[model samples]
Target chain A: MKKLFFLIGMTFFFSSCEKEGVLTKGSNPIPTINNTAVLKYSGTFVPTSGITVQGNVNIYAQGNKYQLQIENITITDGPDLKVYLSKSDTPSSFVNLGNFKGNGTSVYDIPAQVDVSEYPYVLIHCQQYNHLFAIAELISKQSN
Target chain B: MKNKLKKALLFSTLFILGYTANAQGCSDAGFCSVGNTFKDAQSEIKNSIEIGGVYGVGEEDVTVFSPYAIYTRIFTNRFAMSAKLTATTANGSFGTISNLGDVFVTGNYKFNTGDYDKSKWSGILGVKIPLTASNDKINNFSLPMPYQSSLGTFDVITGLDLAIKKWEFSTAVQIPLNQNKNSYLSQLAPTDKFDSTNLLERKSDVLFRATYKIKTENQKFIFRPNVLFIYHLGKDSFENVFGQRQTIQNSEGLTINGNLITSYRLSEKNYIEASIATPFVVREVRPDGLTRAFTIGLSYKRNF
Candidate 1:
């Protein structure tokens, strides 16, 4: 048994780098929406205390897919933060976009099952502590 | 008044001891591993080896396949030593990663109580060494907690096992001895500004199990049905994907499981054992990337 363990240890030690699916710090480019997309609604971010958060949220429609583009975003870095489209800053009513990638321009696809038309707010929330960091309420840009 | 109080206390202690003696080990592996009685072959066989595989499937299309080996040696009638090693491969929506898992070494001491039942008790002490760093990542996103092969912490485990007649009862506790500093905050993008220290804190776990064994008429086979209850005292803390240190919610929960354990003796020196366990209740919230619903395993044991 000791000999078998020793053999296994030597094998792993020699082949550590050769192991498949090892974690790497590879880069994943931020997703982008097409230029042909039409802007449906837009909003300016409302900052909350503790972080200077400012950004423009543009909801664009291209065929059947809707893209939520966050532009010129600046927020003090936070832990466990996430982006969401919701009726309020609370998570129960929110549709999770994903974890905050960083303070920058990024686009996320709206799932087909989600009705972005009804959820008018974009919220930055700390999922670990359930703290709302910032919120942006979308308003119609069209001249009614 | 003093005599009455003494009598009350004595009665309570007796009742509690009687209750505990009726409960035995379970299949959770956490408790059952330390609390098991491998029978009276301890004097005849110097060593026993076990090889097995476990598979688990859960929500979000996550799956885990683990193959493991165990070696145990009885140094004397009252003393034994055991070690286990495992490798795990996990795959799901988060991607795939495979690596060596935790390694454990344990020492046990067996003694007898001078009573009518002549019951036996075993005390166990062990340690789990991390074989893989818990902060493993995929494409720069720290792989969710479940994808990591090791919990990234050394754990101290201790427990007690009791055997009387055809019943066995066991309980054990596993506590992390150190914080894993390599837990990278994957939720935060690399560009995100956050604290430099990314540590993951794990909670302690407790298990209680009881089993009743029924032997065949010829005594060549044995069937043991067991029930296990596990509690995760969920105070797990880690830097979130957003780079904030906080406790992961829905982590604390209780699970109840039923297991059917069967062993068939091929000879005096060899046996085949199979066990299937299904969780009847899950009461806590698990992380987004990992889920555990059922576990199954089979192993061959050989004594030398």
Candidate 2:
């Protein structure tokens, strides 16, 4: 046991610099959305808008027994969209909207009364700068 | 009263010892490195910063400097026992940092992190080594330093921690118990010995630590933010210098502070780390005279 610990320690010591991710994405989705693509959706859609367009996508996340669902989103002129959720929205720092590989419609089933009161709206911001692009509103409340 | 305190501690011990005698340590390394969530077989924190800063209350002109060394021994899958030995070097009298150089050995067992991570839960039992250094800066920084020391000090530490992803949260308390009253009486004044009935008497410390970090895969660049908190009371709180009321330590209430530690792994054997600590909330007065500074140092790890 001691020998094994020594070997592991030696490896870690020699390889501290060679290591990569400080934290691994626990579980990732398929066809992940390019953070930039999502940020392009502005509530007010227009042709010559500086940001690109991708509209009406579903969002979902189920950690343990809790479930969250974002029905649909629309793009406007710019990449930043603004939507105000109903009074009952639980804001969460680690929110998972659905996957967005190329671009298509996505849906998520929300549990009956999962408490998502914190993050009332989802800010689809550029992944790089994390700038707020599109804002989402919560209209329905449910539990599973 | 002393017996009651002793019995209280002993009962707590038996309840823990009796139930866990058969249980073993946790998975991975021991105690899960209170500052970090990951565990490795061959482990050495080498040097991890205490992320939080401290804000002191009560008294004034009180300043202190203390450094600590702690180690955890993994016993089994569900629990780990540990010990901490520290040396406190003070800069001023009473009003500032009070407790110094307390050598204590404690046993700790963990509980949570049920399935995913098992290193978070922990219960502690330990003792502090006492000293009668009258010249103690905290008591009388002007008097010189304490050479007369007490060998045995019964202290207790109870703590728990939870780590998820990039964050860690924990709280702990250290209480001094059992004593060599004769030891103090022999060196100082007769009335100076243990107050006898004051089992909960004398000195005790309470602290909290929390940290968040982002590490690179190559282990090259790592940044961690943390906080440290301390609360002192009893003989540990009072420092009398040559019949003069020198200072009133961290006796007031709570002190909150934070630290940012950036470490770069230069090579397999040599790593450089810089820690910058800040005092966020000052309950009483502004922090002065001290570094309010950054600690930059290098550490070498060798598997021998």
Candidate 3:
């Protein structure tokens, strides 16, 4: 019985330290952008309903292309969530920036045809429920 | 101030209604009887059944209700078999509810030292079956871990129990045997298969408990006070749709609790028990949604 107890204790000690290898490590590292920012707008996310959503969104114009960068943001987990550059705070008249990933620092491509200056709000909208969880009003940071 | 008064009134009402109980507390296997059930020969009390319910309010405004039925039968004076079925309903203030938790079975072997008339030691082995179906959804997306009933993993439970005089002490370990591929995802695609690499891995847990029971001269009313310490030794891991595993930083921690248990013996064959526990020590990042605060439970048992 003593030996069996010792064996069981040892097994628990070792198994507790067993850590599995993560399949995707550093897979979403921020890419280096060579183009300098010609026009920039920055804002922080504000939660509307449900879980708390907090993050900073930076809209940078690099020559003809634009980038929508979300940094240090934690969003309330939701379904069919999408990121949008909206004309106003509401979900109407918004340019869909595709799916909104979970809270973290990530970047998305912004279409050049869409006027970033006109649509000054970054909205984390739940597409399934047609609800706006959070909104970030972009303010002019710099314009070259 | 109003909420506190309401809470006090609710607790008092529940306490008065609860009279009988088994050892089911916050964690599983509430009683820590190491050597309390030893018999010299085949006794008349060979079979017993207990029915109980537990209510818990955790962090993140989560409420849990668990109702269980347990049956135990002694084959001889030293061997016993027990089976338990538990139904759980978890509700998140964020509007998520899950029902039907896991069902488990346990087998125990008792051993006594000195004489059969004295207290003895025993070992318990058990397995939990996660046959509960989890289909809870919110806004067309599968509910997160907090609103789901089961971890969807098969777990093994092993423990030791000792009862001597007025004191009872026991320790137990529960470990998951495999990672369960969870179908619940926040933003899963329609084409995504249920067998996707999205998995939930649970960590092993160690529980230590001690209880002292004081009975009246006639033994009609029993008062048992106990303390429980539970350590989550394993890290809860989550595998995303991309098959990348991330350790949920908040799911592993230590909890220390103390509770007063009371029982009333209505007759020789029937009894009632109840317990209320509050956590005095908590060290860990609590998993999102599921919060742990106080627990109340009541049970009725009959022996034949």
Candidate number of the best lDDT: 1
TM-score of 1: 0.62
Compared with the real two-chain complex, what DockQ does model 1 have? Answer: 0.07
Model 3: per-residue lDDT, tens digit, A24-95?
123324344446765488899999956697789988777788888888999888766778888898877776
Task: Give lDDT tens digits, candidate 1, residues B49-163.
Answer: 8777666654445566666777888888778888887766777655676777778888888876434377878888898898865655555355555666666679998988888
Q: What is the TM-score of chain B alone in each candidate?
A: 0.80, 0.50, 0.79
> Candidate 2, DockQ to 2 decimals?
0.00
lDDT of each: 0.68, 0.36, 0.64
Instruction: Give residue A109's error in model 3 in angstroms.
Output: 13
Q: Which residue runs does candidate 3 get wrong by more than 4 Å?
A: A1-144, B1-42, B96-98, B113-119, B133-135, B182-198, B288-291
Ranking by TM-score: 1, 3, 2
Residue A32 of model 1 has an lDDT of 83
Residue B163 C-alpha lDDT in model 2: 62
* Best first by DockQ, ranked: 1, 3, 2
